[model samples]
Target chain A: MELLKQSIRQRGIALSEQVLKVDAFLNHQIDPLLMQAIGREFAARFREDGITKIVTIEASGIAPAVMTGLELGVPVIFARKHQSLTLTDNLLVASVYSFTKQVESTIAISTTHLSAHDRVLIIDDFLANGKAAKGLISIIQQAGASIAGLGIVIEKSFQQGRAELEEMGFRIESLARVISLKDGQITFLD
Target chain B: MELLKQSIRQRGIALSEQVLKVDAFLNHQIDPLLMQAIGREFAARFREDGITKIVTIEASGIAPAVMTGLELGVPVIFARKHQSLTLTDNLLVASVYSFTKQVESTIAISTTHLSAHDRVLIIDDFLANGKAAKGLISIIQQAGASIAGLGIVIEKSFQQGRAELEEMGFRIESLARVISLKDGQITFLD
Candidate 1:
């Protein structure tokens, strides 16, 4: 977490009071070493939870989810943002509003990938309004799978995402929690 | 490669004469152990190439590219499929026609991530018509970076993807090459 926090402090750019761009290391352009460390940290945090799989959304979440899946010795299933020709009709779908893209997109998972037998740990790059996490939870519930927990790389605590997820009885663990982004300065919740 | 071939034989589904689905282990629901082997295989193939970075497209390609980056001890940068708020004006963009999605999406890389001094190794999940690879190549060229090579997990040799990339003077290493997918059976070039 120290490494991640330091990396954020060094490389993260505050685009505005509400936006932090970490495309330098986390999402768009990734430092694989940092990504691997992040994965190991997640595994250490949730190692005893009996997690059977790692679930994530498309694009940004795949890297951390894949790395965490490798560390946890589990399979990873990422919900696709759109339907592809190869995907089957048996699916669990949820609509998520993206604050970044400013659009509502449907995320879906194949019913074949998840079931009552799966205990899933949902992972993602960032949690702001928690809409994506809620959508992932919906798809996981539709599969009749139990939630192991939610692991986030970064959490915008200034927003109500953590509180909302916590109120829903979901166990949330974020590596870096940003308390506020006031006047282009990021405050971390120690 | 034998392990990959066996996985394809056991889990891969031939939906038609042209489509082979390995979603059970490769893309949708990913097996982390097999995925690690894939990364190691790619690393081995391109180990001598002095790869400074691993380049890939968004969504599906991130996992393998991340793993390869970890193995190669390099950074991994995935091109964004859409313009987001966090992205800057400095970018190298290319339009790719997706055979699966039946759409043309522009993939862009931040110019900050690539430069003329870097050697890029492009990684992807599947190679069919090679449109994605060509798009990536265009982005790399735009960055003025030297290409180390292209590593593909599966190549549908029945398609003209390989021939086209090879004609363009790009070195391609595919873990498994399918000679044909005829009568709902897959034939490997090996």
Candidate 2:
């Protein structure tokens, strides 16, 4: 978490009070070593939760989730943002609004992957509005799967995402908690 | 590679002579151990090539590329399928046609990630028509970077993808090569 916070301070660009761009390391461009460390930390935190599978949204979430899945010795399933031609049947879908993109897209997973007997750990790159996390949780619940907890790489503490999920009684573990990105300064929660 | 072939044989679905779905392990639902093995194999093949970075497209390609990046101790960058709010300046863009989706989309990478002095290795999940690979190759060329090779998780040998890239003189390493998917039978090329 310290390393991640340092990376944010050095490489992360504070575009606005609401947006922090980590395209340098965590988003578009990835540091595999950092990802591996994140995976190890998440695994250490939730190792005893009886997690059967790791779930995430496609694109950014896959890296951390896959790394954590490797550490946990489980399979990782990524919810696709859009429906591909190959994926047409037996789907569990949820509508998500991306505050960054300012677009609403449906995230879906095949019902063939998750079931009632499974316990799931949700992971993602950033948690701001919690829309993506909520979407993932909806799909997981539709499959009758139990939620183990939520693992986040970077959480915007100024946002209502964490508060909302915690209100829902989900155990949330965020590695780096950003308290403020005001006046082009990045502040972390103690 | 035999393990990969075995996985394809057991879990891969032959939707048609042109479409083979390995979503059970390779694409949708991913096996981390297999991905680690894949990363190791890619690293072993390109270890002596002086690969400075691992390049891949978003979603499916990220897992294998990250694994390979981890093994080789290099950074991995994935091109975004679409432009987001944060990514609006100094971009390297390429148009890719997805045969599976029957749609054309532009993939872009930030200029900050790639440079003239970098040497890149391209990694992808599947190679059919080679459009994605060609698009990536174009971006790398635009950045004035040298390409070490291409690493593919699965190759449809019957398709023109491998032949076309080979004609362009790119060294390609495909873990599992399928000769045919005719009559719903998944055959591998030796």
Candidate 1 residues B53-132, lDDT tens each? 99999878888898899999999999999889999859899999999888999999999989999999999999999999
Steric clashes per prediction: 0, 0
Deviation in angstroms for B30 in model 2?
0.8
Question: Cα lDDT of model 2 overall?
Answer: 0.94
For model 1, how many clashes? Answer: 0
Give the CAPRI class of candidate 1. Answer: high
What stretches of model 1 exceed 4 Å from their correct place? none
Which 10-residue window of candidate 1 chain B scores lowest in summed lDDT?
B26-35
| Chain A TM-score by candidate, in order | 0.98, 0.99
Task: Report model 1's interface C-alpha RMSD after superposition on the true interface residues.
Answer: 0.8
Tell me the lDDT of model 1 at A119: 95
- Candidate 2 residue pairs in backbone clash: none
Q: What TM-score, to 2 decimals, does candidate 2 have? A: 0.99
lDDT score for residue B65 of model 2: 95
Question: Fraction of true contacts kept, per model?
Answer: 0.90, 0.85
